[model samples]
Target: MAAVNRVFAAQLAGLPVFGPDGESIGKVRDLVAGLRLDQQAPRVLGLVVELATRRRVFVPMLRVTSIEPNAVTLATGSVNMRQFHRRPNEVLVLGQLADARAELGGVRVTVADAAMEPTRTRDWVLAKLAVRERSSRLGLGRRRSSLQVVPWTEVSGLSLGDLTEQPQGAGQLLMLFDTMRAVDIAATLRDLPVKRRHEVADAMDDERLADVIEEMPEDDQKDLLGYLAEERAADILEAMNPDDAADLLAELTPADQSRLLELMEPEESEPVRRLLAYSSDTAGGLMTPEPVVLSPDATVAEALARIRNPELPAALATMVFVCRPPQATPTGRYVGCVHFQRLLREPPADLVASAVDTDLPALRPGATLTEVTRYFAAYNLACGPVVDAGDHLIGAVTVDDVLDHLLPEGWRETGLHDVRSADPMKSEEWERA
Candidate 1:
């Protein structure tokens, strides 16, 4: 009898897969599930992996020999992602998993009914795979076949999972619990080897956790989300980026979907609803609710006071947002923003508009970053502001915040490099949620 901490092969889905050198190969993308229904030596005989670089690869059982906290050791010195056949009955590819997602919020998006053209020709064609839908027993296009292709890429496989049977040993029993309970992101994030990280979105109970995972690559996010209960899925969507959240909501059935949106607080739902109303690719669609703002009565000093307040939002500062007193318009209302440094240099009695640096570029809430970037170069502003049709301020986001999209993990949590910026954060400035 081994310790319970050790996961059996059947329980290893969603565990972190590692490399021999102890570096991460990335999580196990998904397990080959259907084939085992007949014989059941193990719940899964193989794992379909989508790599960080956007490539899809396959790993059969038997080749795996040892699993550890950081790596998955394989029996063969050479591992090919595609050597194992992805039988439709035992498929674990991206296209097979996306059909499992549940929609919530008022947002709608179609998962790609496509598959990655495997590019194993290059010893390394690093890529990232995105999963968007679920799969079923029936073949494609049939009423039961909603198989959507998720994306993935490859990394080196470091070690085997659980090290259950040694390189020289065999004899194991397969146990299948719900996939949701079997995988944990925190446990996965800890990079425990032998256990591959599986998509278990439906398994999670915490909206905040789901929200954090939503910011991850789609395949991983979709996997986690698929395991969730419908309402729980909605809760996670409610806590996500509006554009992303809205997109998922649109995928749900009308009934299960609406119930989840209704579960959200009005403020969260409103932005997601607003995002849902826009054309996905248009400036109106991609723009976030974050925009710079100013209070009409706010003197340059007072405005600087807000910027200097460490507690003001990190995402908001990038745009130099100004706050209006009660009952302010949402857009086109600010006279303009003054330079933060200029406040101290100017005379004490200087009028705010006099200090107004109007030189800073401005943007409507509908403006996309692509459109706003030109202004950033033309005017040299750190970022731009967004406004509603009425010209009232909504939220202010900056380029750094925009850069969150580029980060391996987005800015939901401040990272190590954020220290200099985060140092300015003040507890007093945050609006109580």
Candidate 2:
């Protein structure tokens, strides 16, 4: 994962969006977002994209690679060109997701596998991974192992510092990440406005910042989301725990839901769509998307091999259905599946069928919401799989999906009472309470 770059909804409001080759793709126009309230962090759902033709487009956050003051970047240069060449609303949302699946989204933040360890040796040795035939000839003893050093090659992208690098007495950061760099300070404005701080924080290249901000109360999230476009807000929500994703989407309009889902892949969107389709209180409706699938006759080595493919996405990976054959209709009956994570704990050659939880509870088509709720409460089950009369896996219902439906009107609330002004800090007073 790379670091996430950020900017306030206000600053990014009119930033020009650019292609990788620095072509002017368009500019940021307005931010589409949910409502918010008192001193809250924000959530972004999407962006109102404006092409050079003066046509406005709705770009979901996932498609937004980065947000800088002068320019925005996308994961791909060719985003729905067919639609872009057409008029507004003619562009489909799914095309953006297809682009994202191809790794089109630009860097939201810059990231590195970093550690916060203190070090002693100022002088250092380096590895030349980028150079061919450079097999790390520089050798150091174990005593030098603790020397603080970062592999320069590991840096994938570098944010162009504000066209100036003058060493100042007090440093005025373009943004503040948890990371500290050895640089001369220009000037530190101790009294920068909170809104400014929020905007500056948007430039941070930290994925964890969003998480920590989101972990605050809904009121804060609403405020923060107010500073982001709806598409970006939706991107963060989609990346969140499924439970949070459902909760956030519930507060959005049907049109927004449709738009956001269109930007998400079928693998990620389909299950949440299923979860959203339920009454938040039923088992057929409350099952987690994650499931255990298996090849009915798979050998231990085969089973182990599947687990090693981390590149395989989560929803697909979680399914361990032990069908008689792999990836097709089975000749034999559907056998049991062992949870992939737990498979390693047992004897290496243990068959999946023999290792499965035989007494697993499942849901039928017509199970009542109350009955299913009781099953979860009494059994502490995350969810149960739903099967037809033939016992073939049809779908699942997770507990969070149930809450999305069962929770009172409060669950969908974005907690933003609009302030008097357009900006989040100055919303309508009626929106405040």
Candidate 3:
């Protein structure tokens, strides 16, 4: 068999695979490895090859005859061409593990890369991980950075479900997730098995769980809520955006929905209740009740500060509503809105009233989805305020929520949102976890 000392999983992926007769067969798409409790390292199962037909098939390690930088040669020209299917115990090396966070030698580090070593018997095993540690030194009044690689065995918190049982490992896992975006964390959780997904969710706090739940698909959101205790689920719902919370509640039976609503804080439950009053396809159902609102007399600086809230979605932060006294929805009276650009152009000390765009119109709560779509399209608005019969601003509909309603059904299950990179080393931002 042709030999190579070692190669990182990232480098091995995308290399062409060949038959014993030197005929091209396919290219490496990913590597499958079986997790073992008794062994410190995971055993390499095989390579996932994408054929010319765009179909993926499995090539066992035993069938591999030579390992080279450019191509992997199989022992025989004849091979099974069945499509590959993942076993319960197997995980994709490049797909799942390459950029995951791991604890190496008691220090948390990013798994920037991974390597595999060939065994004496001509098989290959996962050998080491290139863990990155970011450190800065003051040299000549300038900062200097360095990166270090660590052995895979030294990594203790790589496994997902293991954290559920190990207190220290759970803490490390939580810390790792603390640095990651909620959307990214949700994507990772969705890839894991149900049991592991529950374990990870159990370890997260209610606020963090709420953030991640908002990013999950409707089915996943319901599954996770169903798994949690009623009280815990209520608390998480309270923490989520009113629009998202209402959407999730709409999926449950009336009895369950009412029970959960009763368990939530009155203030938190009120907005959701009002939203639930509207049909799911209506503008009221798709809008968020907590848009930034200020009296026309409020200063530009105050409006800017409100929009600066990191938790606010980008579209909602683009404009601030100007309302009359009472200042809460149904706002005393809808006046106008000041776009963020107008706020920036005016002096901070200037009154928001001076910047109000009075020409922009608001949508009635009962406006149909098609009407909302036409409103957004005709005005090129990122978001539009929703009002009642008295012209009171109740909430605002964001473009994202509109698109979510308009997209094809079962879009989430089609893998349209799984954007994780298969090769970390080839990523533009490899240094990021």
Number of the top TM-score candidate: 3
Better of 1 and 3 by lDDT: 3
What does candidate 3's lDDT look like per residue over 278-351, in tens digits?
99999999999999999988999999999999878999999899999778777888999988988999999999
What lDDT does candidate 3 reach at residue 138?
Answer: 39
lDDT of 2 by residue, 1-433 (tens): 0243323333554478876667786666444332223212122334556554434444555556665546778765223321112122121111111011110023121221121111132111112111111123456652311212223233222211210121111111332322322110000111122343344435533344344443444554555555666666656656654544554565567887787778766666665775677554455444544444556555655677776786443444543556554333211344555655666766667666666665656676467877777766875555455654676665555565555556554322221221122232222212112
TM-score of 1: 0.44
Best by lDDT: 3
TM-score against truth, every candidate: 0.44, 0.39, 0.68
Candidate 2 regions off by >4 Å?
1-223, 241-243, 265-267, 299-345, 364-369, 377-383, 388-433
Candidate 1 residue-wise lDDT, 1-433, digit = tens: 1112223223344466655565565456445433222221223344544344333345544445565544455443444532223443443322232222222122222222212222223111112222222234456665633333222222111012212122211111111222432222332221211222332222334654654464454444555556566666666776676666765665556675577778788877887777667654334455556443465555666555666667444544544444445422244455566666676776655555566656555566666656655655676655455556665554344555445434555332222233232233233112111
Error of 3 at 55 (Å): 17
Query: Per-residue error at 56 for model 2, in Å?
Result: 43
